[model samples]
Every structure is written in structure tokens, then in C-alpha cells.
Target chain A: MTILFLILAVLAIVGASAAMAFRSAVHAILALALAFVSLAILYLSLDAQFVGFTQIIVYVGAVAILAVFAIMMTRSDSAHHHTEVFSKSWLTGLVLAGGVFTVLAWAVLGDKTQHAAADAPAPVTTVTQIGEALMQRYAFPLEIMGLLLTAALIGAVVLAMPLLSNKSGAKSVTKGDAR
Target chain B: MTPLNGYLLLAAFLFSIGLAGALTRRNAILVLAGIELMLNAANLNFIAFWRYGTHPEALTGTMFAIFSISIAAAEAAVGLGLILAVYRHFKTTDLDEIDSLKG
Candidate 1:
């Protein structure tokens, strides 16, 4: 089990790095999907069965597919081949990320309590318990989340909706020729 | 069982990688994907801590993960829709090219 977990973690990190490393949008999305799958496996190993499955369905089924659909919809002029990153920008990002990782590594390594925590056997979480908690203690937040999703849906429709008049049609037509 | 530090360090690396992707990438969809990665890393941390924490019976962390996924879904929908809208009006998805709003 430990070896399996380690392998999945390494694979996940590789997939995430590939997501960042790739220049093509399609390839990046593929790598992102791979990372998500590995993460779901990691979650399962940790006994987070419900969350793991949710990760698979949401990330693999919904978000990645949504991104691919968006990519297809907007690929008018071979847009996927666009220069994906700036040289200085990625260097700066790497430097910043490395610094943060060093800090986190230092803190995690220095903590003694974590060693004790790791020895305890992990408890299995049930979907019924999670459901009860959400419906009871977290009922209000759940409703708010539903409301938020509804609002976001409406907002997306509004933003992506083409104007009924000729003016918005003009914007769409002029898009290709516009300098 | 894997060491708690191992999971913690893994989560840290996942977050850092996601941060790099978000900071460096120019493509709007990739940026959103990076943000999703970061969110998932946080979720991983939540589950890990819950698994090893004193109160493993309480499903608070799992509850949070569910909520986070829902929020992320909403964010992706709105963000991609905005990307489509910008592409329609500006004729480009490259953030560098869409500079008219840089007043």
C-alpha cells in the first residue's frame, strides 16, 4: 500500500508538471486529466472514498471535458499553437514556486507531531456520515452553494450570449479581420 | 500506512506546481486548470489531515472537499464562458493580445 501510494504521488506530480510544461493546450489538458486521476487514487488510498470518487467525476468527467469543449469552440485559426508562455514569466514563476516549496518543506520536516499522527490507523469515512453532516450542520452553506451555482450559471449565459441586435453580430463578424 | 509527512510534502509539492502553472501560463484555460490543480491539492491536504488527525470520525474535511468541488465547478463554468466571450469580441485568447482593457 505504501509503495502504491508513493508511485501514485510521483505520477501525479509528473502529470501536473507536464500540464505546466506542455505548450499545446490540448496536451496540457490531457496531462491535467492524468494528474486528476492520480489524485483520485491518492485520495482513495487515504480512505477518502467519497471525495475520491467526487474528484474523478467532477475533474475527469466535467471540468476537463468542459475545457476541451471550450478549446474546440475557439480554435478558429489554429489557436492551440499560440505561444503559450513567456520566458521571463515562467522563470519568475519557477523561482517563486521553489522558494515557497522550500519554506513548506522546512516547516513540514521540522514538525514532530506529524510523525505521531502517521502511526494511527486511518478510519474509514462513510457516505452516510458525510451526507448527514452536510444536511445537518452544513445545511445553510449547502443552500448557499446551490444559490451560488445558479447565479454563476445565469452570469455565464449572460456573458456568452450574443446580442440579439446587429451590433453584437458585428462584433462577432469583425473578430477575425479586426486588428 | 504512509507517513503523514509524506502526504504533507506531497500536498506542498502539488500546490507549488499548481502555483507555477498559474503564475506562468498565458493561456486562459490553462490558468483555470492550474487553479483547479491548486484547489485539488488543498483538498488532498484536507483529506490527509482528516485521515491522520485525532478526530477522524468527524467528516468536516470531507464536507469541505465537496463544497470546494462545487465552487470550483462554478468558477470553471464562468471563467470559460468569459473566455469565449472575449475570444468572440477580441479575436484572440492570448492574454498578451487582449490589451484594450489595460487603461
Candidate 2:
């Protein structure tokens, strides 16, 4: 179990690093997908079977594909000519991230309760129980989620759709032609 | 067996990587991918806590993870749509190039 967790952790970290390191946009997105898959596997190893499966279906399946489509749609011929992949302030980002990690790791490692809490056995969590809880205890939030998703879907379409109003329509057409 | 702190450390590491990627990447889509990675890391933390925390029968962490995942999906959709719109207006996906808002 420890070995599997280590492998998945390494895979997730490697994939995330590759996503950042790759220059090509498509390759970077693909690497992100790999990271997402490894994270889902980690969820499974944590005995979160439902969440793991949902991660595969939602993240690996939907979000990655959506990103790929967005990339394809936004493609410009000049995109390939870019010299640098990372931003100019990359060192700042790296230093900040490293600092955050160090602080978090120190807090986690120093926590005395975590070591004492290891005596509890892993509890069983089945999908049926989760489903029941969702339908009973979490029904309100579930409905709200459905509403939020619908709103997001509509909002995305509106945001991406071309401006078709009489005043902006011609301008939008000219912009399309320029691209 | 790996202890809870091990998972917490891993989550922290992943979160940091995602933060670095989001801040340092040039492409807007890649930036969004970094955000997704950060969200996943948080989800991992939630599951880790659920697995190891007391009162597992309440399944609070699991429920939080599920809701968070759904919210993240919505966030991704809206963010990508915004990216698409910005791409249309600017004709480029480079982060530095889209600096009209900079005062």
C-alpha cells in the first residue's frame, strides 16, 4: 500500500511538472490530463472509490477535453513562433510556491495529533451510503449544484458566443477576418 | 501504511506545483490547467482527511470533496469560456500580451 501511494504520488508530481515544462500547448494540456489521472488513482488508493471514479469521468473525461477544445479554438498561426514558454516572473512564482510548501510541510510534520491519530482503522465507505447521504442529508446542496451547473452552461455559451447585435456584429465580423 | 501527514504533505506539494504552474505559464489554457491541478490537490486533502479523521460515518469530507469537484467543473467551464472570449478579442493566448487591464 505504501509503495502504491508513493508511485501514484511520484506520477502525479511528474505529470504536473511536465505540464508546466512542456512548450507546446497541446502537449502541456495532455500532461495535465496525466496528472489528473494519477490524482484519481490516488483517490482510489485512499479508498474514495466513488470520488476516484467521478474524477476519472469528470476531470479526465470532461475538463481535459474541454481544455483541448478551447486550445484548438483559440489557435493562431503566430502561437508557434513564441520564443519563451514561461512568464518573465517565473522565479517569483517558484520562490513563492517553494515557501508555501515548506511552511505547510513543517506544520504537517510538527502536528502531534496526526501521529497519535494513526491508531484508528480505516473505515468502510460504500457508494450506496454516499448516495443515500446525498439524497437525504445533502439534497439541498445537490439541487443547488444542478442549478449552478445549468447557470454555468448557459453563461459559458453566452460568453463565448459571437456578439451578434447590429452595432457589434460588423465589428466582430471584421475582427474574425483579421484573425 | 502511510500516515495522514504523508497525504497532507503530498497535497501541499501538489498545491505548490499547481500554484507555480498557474503563475508562471504563458498560455491561458495552461494556466487554467494549473488551477484544475490545485483543485484536485485540495480534493486529495479532503479524501485524506475523510479516510483518517474521526467521525468517518458523517462522511463530511467526502461530501465536501464531491461538491468541490462539481464546483470546480463549473469553474473550469466558465474560465475556459472567458479564455475563448479573450482570445477572440486579443487574437492571442499569451498572458503578458493581454494586459489592457493593467493601469
Candidate 3:
């Protein structure tokens, strides 16, 4: 199990890095999907089946699709036609990323091993436990999240309205010109 | 068999890559992808700590991960909406060129 997890973890990191490095939006999103899948596998190895499923459903299923749709909807033929231009800030990005990685790596490893020699207590997490915890301990935050989603939905509708009206105006103008 | 350190290292690497993408990408959508990567990296850390850390009963990390995912979704929705609006106005998605808002 540990070996499987190690491999998956490596795959996830490599896939995510590749996704970040790619210039093509479509390819980058595809790599992200791969990374999400690998993370879901990692979650399973950790014995969090519910979380793993949620990760796949939310990240891979919904978010990935939404990203692809957004790219397709907004991207022009010219945008997709041009060769990708490498950014001048690539070196700076690499340096900052390297610094963060080194710091986090040190901190994570610096901590003493807390688990004893005894076999890890079997993971006791369940859907019911998580549900109860959310309702009892996290109900307020959950309600807040609902409000946030509602606000986002309304905002999206409002933002799209102008485009819709413009299209309608263009249609009417064409009709008047034909007459 | 993988040790706890292995997962930790992986998470760190993923986070850094995401950070790099966020910094280097000029496209707003790509930048959002980078941010998503960073969030997932944090989620990995949360699960790793839950599996290996001393506090067994504290399911705080998992709960936080769930909340973060929800927020990420909401962020993506609003961001894409804004991107679409910008594209409609300018007929392009290049961040560098969308400078009319700067003044």
C-alpha cells in the first residue's frame, strides 16, 4: 500500500508540474486532470475513500470540465492559432518555487515521527462521521459556503447579461438592414 | 513501501510547481489553474497529516480540505464569468493587453 502510494504521489507531482509547464491551455488542463486522478488514488491509499471520491467528483469531474468549457468559450481562433510565447518571468518563477519547495520540505521532515511502532490504528473515518462533524461542528461554515455559491451564481448571471443583450441587438440591426 | 516523508515531499513539490505557474503565466485562466494546483497541494498535506500526525481525533484538516474545495469551485465560477466578460469586451483573453482597467 505504501509503495503504491509513493508511486502515485510521485506521479501526481510530476503531472502537476508538467501541467504548469505546458503552454497549451488544453494540454495543461489535461495534465491537471491526470494529477487530480493521482491524488484521488493517494486519498484511497490513506484510507479516506469518501474524500477520494469527492476529490474525483469535484475536481476531476466538475472543475476540469468547467475549465475546459471556459477556455473553449472565451478562446478565439487567433488565440489558439499562435505559438505559445514563453514568459520573461520564467526564471523568477523557478527561483521562488524552488525556495518554497525547499522550505516546505525541510519543515515537513524536521518534525519527529509521532506514530508508534504499533500498527496504525485502522482508519475510523466514515461518511456518517464526516456528515455528523459537518452538521455539528461546521454547520456555520457550511451555511456560509452556501451563501458564497449563491453569490457567485448571481454574479455569473449578471456578467453574462451584457453579452446576451449585445447579441440580440446585433440580430435586430441585421434584420433592419435587410429590410 | 512509501514513508510519510515521501508524501510530504510530493506535496511540497506540487505546491512549488503551482506557485511557479501562478507567477509565470500571463493568461488569467492558466493562473487560475496554478492556484487550483496549489489548493490541491494543500489538500494533500492535510490528508497526509491526518494519516501520520499525533492528533487522531482532530479531523480539522479533512474538514478544512472540504471547505477549501468548495471555495475553489466558487472562485472558478466567478473567475470564468469575469474572463468571459473581459473577452466579450476586448475580443481577447491576453492579460497584458487588457490594460484599460489600469488607469
Candidate 4:
């Protein structure tokens, strides 16, 4: 079980890195989907059934599909047009990322002594326990999250209105001219 | 046997890749994908710590991951809407050519 977990972890890391490195949006999304699945597997290995299922459903099913849809909507027929738009400073990106990684590594390693006790077996965080906490203690935050989702839906409708109107308006203008 | 440090290192590597992608990507949508990767990296760390460091009483990590997933959904909706709006006006989703909004 431990070896299987280790292999999955390594695969997840490699897949995620490939997702980030791929220039093509389509390829990147595919890589991300693989990475998400690997993560779900990792969750299973950790005995986190709920988290694993949710990871598959949310990341692989919903988010990845959304990303693919976005890519399809924006892509043009000509390869030249697509390539022309993605010019950026790759070297600076690498340096900045490396610097951030080094800092995070230091922070994570700094409290090594504090984490030595953590090497022991801890109780598994089950779904029922999490549900109880959500209802009993963090109910307010959960309610707030619902409100936030409502607000986001309203915002999406408002943002989409212009495009919807423009398409219908163009049709009307053409019809009026035909008349 | 896999140690907690192994998970932490994997998380760090994933995060670094996400950082690089977010920094270098020109398309707003792709940048959003990069952000999602970074968020997942953090989520992995949360779950790892919950499994290894604390007792079952600290299920904060699991709850936080759920919340983060919902937030990611909301972000994607708004972001894609903005992308559509930008495409309508500019007739393109290229980030470099979107300078009119810039001061």
C-alpha cells in the first residue's frame, strides 16, 4: 500500500508539472485531468474516501470540462494566430517560481522538530466528523458560502448579458435591413 | 515507506510548476488553470497534514478543501464570463493585445 501511494504521488507531481509546461491549452487540460485523477488516487491511499470522490467529481468532471470548453471557444483555425499571442518572459517566470519554491521549502523545513511527533499514527478524518463540525461549529461560514455562490451566479448573468444582447441585436439589425 | 516529507516535497513541486505557468501564461483562461493547480497543491498539503499531523478532531483540512472547491467553481464561472466579455469587445482572447484597459 505504501509503495503504491508513493508511485501515485510521484505520478501526480510529474503529471501536474507536465500540465504546467505544455504550451497548448488542449494538452495542458488533458494533463491536468490526469493529475486530478492521480490526486484522487492519492486521497484513496490516505483513506480519505470523501475527499477522493469529491476530487474526481469536482476537478476531473467539472473544472477540467470547463477548462476544455473555454479552450474550444477561444481557439481559432489557424495555428499561426494561436502561437502569435503567447509570447512571455519564460526565464523570469522560472526564476520567480524557483525563488518562491526555495522560500516555501525553507518555511516547511524550518519547523522540523515541531513535526517530529507528527510522524506517529493520527486518527483518520472521516466524513461524519467533518459534517458534524460543519453543522455545529462552522455553520456560519457554510451559510456565507451559499450567499457567495448566489452572488457569483448573479455576477455571471450580468457579465453574460452584453454578449447575449449583441448576438440578438445583430440578428435584428440584419432582419430590419432585409425588410 | 512513504514519509510525510515526501508528500510535502511533491506538493512543493506541484506548486512551483503552477507558479511558473501562472507567471508565463498570456491567456487569462490558462492563467486561471494555473491558479487551479496551485490551489490543488495547497489542498494536498492540507490533507497530508490532516492525515499525519493531527487527530481526527482536526478535520479542518477536509472542510477547507470542500470550501476551496466551491470557491474554484465560482471563480471559473466569473472568469469565463469575463473572458466572453473580453472576446466580444476585442474579438480575441489574447492577453498581450488587451491593453486598452491598462493605464
Chain A TM-scores, per candidate, are 0.84, 0.87, 0.81, 0.78
Task: Write the residue-wise lDDT of candidate 1 on B1-103 in tens digits.
Answer: 3477788899899999998888877777787888999998889888878787778787877888889999999999999999998987776676667778842
Residue pairs in clash, model 3 = none
Stretches > 4 Å off in candidate 1: A76-84, A114-119, A164-179
Residue A18 error for model 4, in Å? 2.2
* Per-residue accuracy of model 1 over A40-93 as CA lDDT, tens digit each: 999898889999999999999999999998888787223336454643467888
DockQ of predicted model 3: 0.59
Writing each residue's lDDT as its tens digit, candidate 2 over A69-127 gives: 99889883234785578889999999999999999998887777633265566678888
The sequence of per-residue lDDT tens digits that candidate 4 reaches over residues B1-103 is 2366767777887888888888877777777778888888888888877777646456777778788888988888888777876776676766767789742
| Comparing 1 and 3 on lDDT, the stronger one | 1
Name the fnat for model 3: 0.56
Summarize candidate 3's per-residue lDDT along A35-100 as a digit string, tens digits. Answer: 999999988887777778889999999888988998888773234566443356678888998999
TM-score of each model's B chain?
Answer: 0.91, 0.95, 0.86, 0.89
Candidate 2 — which pairs collide?
Answer: none
Ranking 1 against 3 by DockQ, winner: 1
Best by DockQ: 2
lDDT of 4 by residue, A1-179 (tens): 26786788778877877777666777878888898899888877766778889989988998899878877776731233546434467679889989988988777666544442434654656678878988988899999999999999889778855524567588765665366
Instruction: For model 4, name the residue pairs that clash.
Output: none
Task: Give the poorly placed runs of model 2, Cα more than 4 Å off.
Answer: A76-79, A114-120, A165-179
Candidate ranking under DockQ, highest first, comes to 2, 1, 3, 4
lDDT of 3 at B69: 84
lDDT of 2 at A84: 70
